[model samples]
Every structure is written in C-alpha cells, then in structure tokens.
Target chain A: MHELAVTREIVDVAAEKAEGARVRRVVIEIGRLTPVAPDCVRFYFEICAAGTAVEGAELEIREIAGNARCRACEASLELAGPVEGCGCGSFDLEILAGRELRLMELEVY
Target chain B: MCDHCGCSTEGHEHVHEHTHEHPHEHETSRTVRIEQDILARNNRQAEWNRGWLASRRLVALNLVGSPGSGKTTVLERTLKELDGQMNAAVIEGDQATDRDAARIRATGRPVVQIATGTGCHLDARMVKGALEKLDPQPDGLVFVENVGNLVCPALFDLGEQAKVLIASVTEGEDKPAKYPHMFAAVQVVLLNKIDLLPHVSFEMDAFLGFLRQVNPRVRVIAVSGATGAGMLEWYECIRASIH
Candidate 1:
C-alpha cells in the first residue's frame, strides 16, 4: 500500500529530527480524502519504525475532514465522503482541505 | 565521606561523581508542521523523469485502466495502422509475465517489460529505471501500459506526458464515478470495447454525464480495438501530441 511508503518517509523524517534522542511519541495529521488508509498507516508505522529511534513510540493520527467551496452556489460545504459534485449539481468546485498527510510533532527525551 | 544533605550515601556519591551535567534543560516536545504532500516525492521524481524524456525529445503516454480494458489491443492496432508514420516504443507493466511486452515486441517495436511481482501499481521510480535501461532514445511515441489496476495505479505518476484512462463499456457506465480520481487526473479518457455495445447494455449518455461530472476537461474518445471503430481520432490525438 502507498501508506507504507508514506510511513517510511515519516519515520525517516522523525529519526532525522530525533538526532540520537529517544522518541516517545509521533503525531501525524491525515486528511480524510488523502487516499491513505489510517489502519494501513498504523500497521506500517510499526514495521517502519523498527530498530529506529521511534521504535515502540506512540503513533498518533488526527484525521482532517474534506472541505470544499462550490463555485456556482458560492457555498462552503464539508464533503461527506468522496463525492465530487456540489448540491447544486456543479462539478466546478475548489477543494479546500482533507487531502493532507503530514508529520506534525514529535515528543522525545 | 558523608554530606549533611545526602539521604543515601551510595546514590549521592554516584550523583556527585557525574560531572557532565548540563545546566540548560532539553526540550521534551518539538513541533514540526511539515505540511508536505504524501505524493510530493513521487511527483518530484515524475517531474525529473519528464525532464529527462523531454531532453531526449520523446513523447510518452501513461496508459491506465483495469485489466482486460483492451490497452494492449489498442496499442497493437495503433502500431499496425501508424506503421512508418510514427516510431513507437513500449514500456509494458504487469504484475507478472512478459506477455504484454512480448505482444508489443511482435509489433516490431522496441519493447521493455517491467514486472512488478505483486505490486499493484507502477511508481515513478520504476519507470525511471525502465527509461534508463532503454536508452539511446527514439524520437516518437513511448507508451507506458501501466499495471491493470484502476485504484492503485491512479495514485502513481509514471512521468508520462499525458495520463490516459481507458474504460471499456463492458465494465459499466458508472466506472468514472466509482473511480473518479483516475478520471479526474487523466487528460484523455478512452472508451474502449464499443464493439460489444450491441451485446451489452452500456448507456452512453450516463457514462458521458458521469465523466463530465468528475472532470469536465477530460476529452473522451470511444473506440473498439476489435472492430477498428473510431480509432482514427485516437491515432490523430496521439500523433498531435507527439508532434
């Protein structure tokens, strides 16, 4: 899964920042529409963090909801799922959020 | 050896013996708001690959679709029809076997096969390797037939000039809605297997409506590789892109 690849990058970036410090927890922000499965990320984070500074560390994920602005109706709406068109039947909408996958913070000692 | 403030002499002695203590406190928490995109790295690689291809003046198209979407058949007919007019090379991707590559090779064009071996999609790095191996580049079309998958392959960018999503009528009219990301990211939507339309209940209006809803900018071309219907326009699009 692509989540595994993303997890590897997270682990690499966290380890680089840790700089020999023992990591206690890692917090990540994931958007709902990012195409990455949260369960898959959690499963792979364990595998990727093995033998690294973030080993056995807590993996925290905060899911962000998808938000969009309708161009036709000029209404801001939170997407329920992956539906693209607006309530006004307009596909010309701009995505605001919920496509984010970022490593937010790290707790270390 | 006893001190007035020491509770335990052994522990106090160890504490006093450690002289490398720093006065400043270390931060226990560090915040890094790395709002980096997950696909950013892959996109970078894809851009690099694109630059390399562009430097060589090669036109590459990433053909994406589900299994049995007539991708290979379309390519076969394309090569046969455009013989001597366009010099084409193929980079065939599959989970296993060189069957697609073999078929393309039979068309008398240089073909390279990248077998993923259980990987559901082809990443930019894989294509980069294929391009490196197939050097001394030709000046015409380079078709990268991605692994037969609708979902996973849609996420990966293979450094092609255009991403072409192929969906046959036999699959159903709702494919564009079901796999909107694939359709949304593609430049051209090839509706293949129109020859079987008479045998199947494929609604053209509903399909076009769904496709437009997902991506209004995507150009649609319907063709039946088996019967050679509506292939001229497809060939013209390819030729125009190459030129």
Candidate 2:
C-alpha cells in the first residue's frame, strides 16, 4: 500500500535528523481526515527502519481531531470524519484542520 | 535504582531522568525538534511541477478510477473528439503494461507510460520525470491517467490542475460513500458508462445523493465512452477549462 511509501519517508526523515546518532523514539501527528491508519504505518515503519539510524526507535502516533467551520453561519465544529453539513444546516463548510501528517520530533542518543 | 536509563536511586520514579547535578554537564540522549511533514519531499516536487506547468500556461488533469471503469476509454474518446481543436498529450500510469500508452499513441498524441511495478499510485516525482520525457508543447493540455485505484491514488498529488474521478454505474451507487476520501479529494466526477443504465440496477437519484453528501461542490458528468453519448458536453467542459 501507500503506507509503505509513507513509512519509508518517515524513516528517511528521522534518519536525516538524527545525523550519526541513534534514534530512540519518533513522534508523529496524524490528522483524522488524513485517511492513514496508524497501525499500518507502524507495521511498515518497523520494516523500513531496519538497519537504519531509527532501527530500534519507538514510534508514537498522535491523532489530531478534525475541525471545520460553517461557510454560512461561521460556526466552528469538531467532526469525527468528513460530514455532509454543519449543525446550522449549512452544507458549505471549510475545513480548518485535521488533514495533517507530520513527524513532530525525534529522541536521539 | 532504575533499570532503564541508570540514573540515581533518589526520586527516580520510572521516568527518564536526564537532570545532571553539574551545571555544564550534558546527557548523551537528546530530543530533536523535527516538526516536518512526512510528505514534504513529494509536496516540494509537486510545487515545482505546478510552477513549471504554470510558466508554460499548460493545464494538467489527473484521472483516477477503479480498473475496468473505462478510464482508458474515456481518454481515447476525449482525444478522438478534441482531435484538432485542442493540442493534448497523455501520461499513462499502470502497475505493469504500456498498452494504454500504445492506445493513446494510436490517436496521434504524445504519450508516456510509467510502469510503477509494485507501487499502487503515481507520485509527483514520477509525473515530473514523465513530463520531462514527453515535453508537451506550451499552452497544451496533459492528462495524467493514474493507476486504477480508488484509494491510494487519491492521497498523492501529481501536480495536476484537478483530479477527475471516473466511476461506472456497474461499480454500484455507494462508491462515493464507500470511498469518501477519494470522493472528497476530487474536483470533478465523471459517471462513465451511463449507456448501461437500463440494464443495471443503478439508481441515478441515489448515486447523485451520495455523491453530494460526500462532496457538495463537485461537478458530475454522466457519459458513455462506448456510445459517445454526452461526450460533447465533456469536450465543452475541456474547452471551457483551458480557455
């Protein structure tokens, strides 16, 4: 799947950040609307990280909640996933957040 | 005493204790603030490709759909109808074959075939490479037909002006609901194979309702590549877009 490619990128990024040091942990933030499974990422990370600087690194994934604002009423709301309309009966909504997939930090030794 | 990091015995509790007694002393372990997007590389390439296309005033559209959804047929039909009116090229992406490229070549259009091997989707870098090989003329239109996939292809940005979803009625009415991410990411939906409406159990009302629920602002065009029905509207849409 594409998760394999994504995981490869994560490892390369972490390894580049670590320089010559060994990475202990890698922290990542994934948004709810990104459509990537944390477990699938983890599965690929283990394989991609093998023999790299992040070989034994522990992966921590944080899910960011989806946030949106109504285009008509300008009212902000949290969504579990992509929704049809806002509570104010407005089908026009602008997504404010929850499409992020970032490598936040790396603990290295 | 803790067994993990080997700090002192006093007030260790079980967390990592990096507090040294000396003022200038430092621990070997450190946390680096990366704060980088995982898709930064791909996004950078996509931006470059976008700028390159914009400088030439060229338009690129990425077409995505499930296999057997008539994506190749749609392109073949588009090229046939828009033959002399519009100058266009095709970038065909598949897991293995260049058969689609041969088909597009038969239409007398420039074509490049990218075989991803085991990869499921085409990334921005792949498109950039293909563009260099094809080297389309200025002010021309480029159609990057992504590998037939409803899932992973939606996640990648190929530096196209917009993504068009090709769905056939035989795939069912709930495709938009089943793959909301793909539906949400596309700017237009081409409901292909409409000529089979009488034979299939597909309901137009339900399909439109589900598509609207998933993406409120997407343009939907119902067409049949085999019958050439409603293809005039498609050519008109293309003309309207580039002009």
Candidate 3:
C-alpha cells in the first residue's frame, strides 16, 4: 500500500543517480522492523519506472537485524521481533535499530 | 563529467576542445554507492509537519486501529469532551468517502478528510495537506485518525506527537503479539468495547499481561464507546501526554 510511495522514491533516487548512464542493478537494505515487503516494492518499482532510466534494473535486497534496549537496565541487545521481557525480567524494552530502508548502491553502465 | 548525460561541458557549444576517454580505458559498468534513505522525502515532509505543529503549539495525536475497532466512535466521544477546554481539529483518513469527516463536523470542530482511494494507509504528504486545510488553533489538539489497519499504517509517520493504538475486545487477546509492529510502535493502547466483556470470551488478564510484555511502558486504557465508561481516562491520558 504505502510501498507505492516508497517504490516511487527508489525509482526517483535511482534514476537521478543513473543520470542517463543506464542502470543495471540497484541494491537495497531492508530492516526487520521496517515492515516493507521486498516483492511488493519490486513489483511497484517496475510499474513506476517504465521506459525510465531504471527500467528492468535488477533489485537485490539485503537484511538488517534489529537491536533493542532494556527499559529497566538500558542494556542494548539484538532483537528478532517483539519479546515479553529482558533477561532480568523487565518487560520494558526499546527498539534501537533495524528500522532502516535505504537504497544502498547501484550498478550503472 | 555530468552524470545526467555523462558529459560535463564547460566552453561554448559547438567549438569545443578535443576531450575524450582514453581508447585503452574500458568502463563496462560502475557501482555507485547511494546509501540514501529511500523514505527521505517522506521523512522530510513529516519533519516539516512536526515543525509546523510545534510552532503553532498544536498537539497532533495519531489514532491507529483495525477497521472495526471503534476508532471513530472513540474520537467522536473524545472531541465532545475537549469541546470547550481544548480546541480540537480532525484529519480523518479512509479508503473512500467523507463520512468520517462528516461525523466529526457535527462536533463543531475544524475537520478535514483524506480519501486514500486504493491506498491502505495515510502518508506524511496527505497529512501535510490536511494540516493546511485544518489550520488548527495554537493551543489546540489535532487528531489524525489513520485509515484502519494495524500493519501498513505503522510504517508511515505523519508527524504526530505520539501514536495511540486501539484494539477491541472482540479482536481477541493475541492481537498485540500477532501485530507486533503496530503494538510496538505506540506508547499507548486502548482496549475498546470494554462493555462487551460480559458477553465476549476475551481474556482481559492475559491480554494485559501480554501487552505489558510486548511494551512494558505502554499505557493501556479500557474504553467503551457505547457506555462511555473510560472516556474521561482517555482524555486525561491525552492531557498528560501533551502537557
């Protein structure tokens, strides 16, 4: 849904970077907590970039793991998703990372 | 070199000095490291909204929930409570129709509606337009009732001071764990339709226990749109958050 907006951004950014050079590939990094589907983004990207500089450019997705902090002890630790408590029995937690959605690089000719 | 055309020209057009890449140079492809945030445009718009709201002393609160979670009902009631004490405005988002906006209009408050059409969630750009149309008073509250959906809405930021997620007892007890993205993003959670507790098989204690586990700092408010049982508490919580 909102991926339409994000996919538009990817095309815009990638095309701008391409600068008539002809895009070959575009690589992106998605975070676990960002809640965006890679397949959906690719589908929209093709539609939004038709006949443009990024048309048919291969898209590669990489993952970024999330990290969290304990609200009680302030200890930062790796997080897979949502959890009930920290190691010390504190239910309070703060997620610090894995929210990233960035266009990392591009292969242009 | 100009990236746009791979040509950065300096002199007058036609009569230019001979310039070319070496014949032996082979440039098949190049990898440019962009490392730019894909949502930078949205982030900028959201930041602008935040600045605009802050300069005007407007407290923007985003309400997120499932379609049948009674978000509109809760808002209709909350606007009533803030009628005189705190001036309020509403920016309602729905897939189609101005019905929500029409409902809020009856409260005699400034209200704007965004019809997303086929879109599932409200983005910052839509919020920007709604804010311009809303023109919330300097010490007022702006309620952004997001298009009802727990998942996609969580990914988009609308420059609200905080996100308030509503879940109904009819939604059962495992919603928090099932939709962790929405539940984790908010600082407050409203368990709507508490009046239905008598008839529903919802396990309130277990739900509360799981919610706390998912977000220990999250404030949970039990509300009933039909009975208006905990509307006051909701208003108080809003006051506590903004002030």
Top candidate, metric TM-score: 2
Write model 1 residue lDDT over B6-89, tens digit each, in one string: 555643433356668777876666654455555667789999999888888899999999999999999899988898897788
What's the lDDT for residue A80 in model 2? 84
RMSD of each predicted structure: 8.1, 5.0, 9.8
The lDDT per prediction is 0.85, 0.91, 0.87
Query: How much does candidate 2 score in TM-score?
Result: 0.91
What are the models' TM-scores?
Answer: 0.85, 0.91, 0.87
lDDT of candidate 1 vs native?
Answer: 0.85
Evaluate model 3 with DockQ and give the value: 0.55
Candidates 1 onward: DockQ, in order: 0.36, 0.65, 0.55
Better TM-score candidate (1, 3): 3
Q: Which digits, one per residue and each the tens of the lDDT, describe model 1 over residues A5-95?
A: 7788788888877888878888888887767788999999889999999998899999999898988899888875565678888877788
Residue pairs that clash (backbone atoms under 3 angstroms), model 3: none
Question: Least lDDT summed over 10 consecutive residues: which range in candidate 3 chain A?
Answer: A77-86
**Ranking of all predicted structures according to DockQ, beginning with the best and ending with the worst:** 2, 3, 1
Off by over 4 Å in 2: B1-27
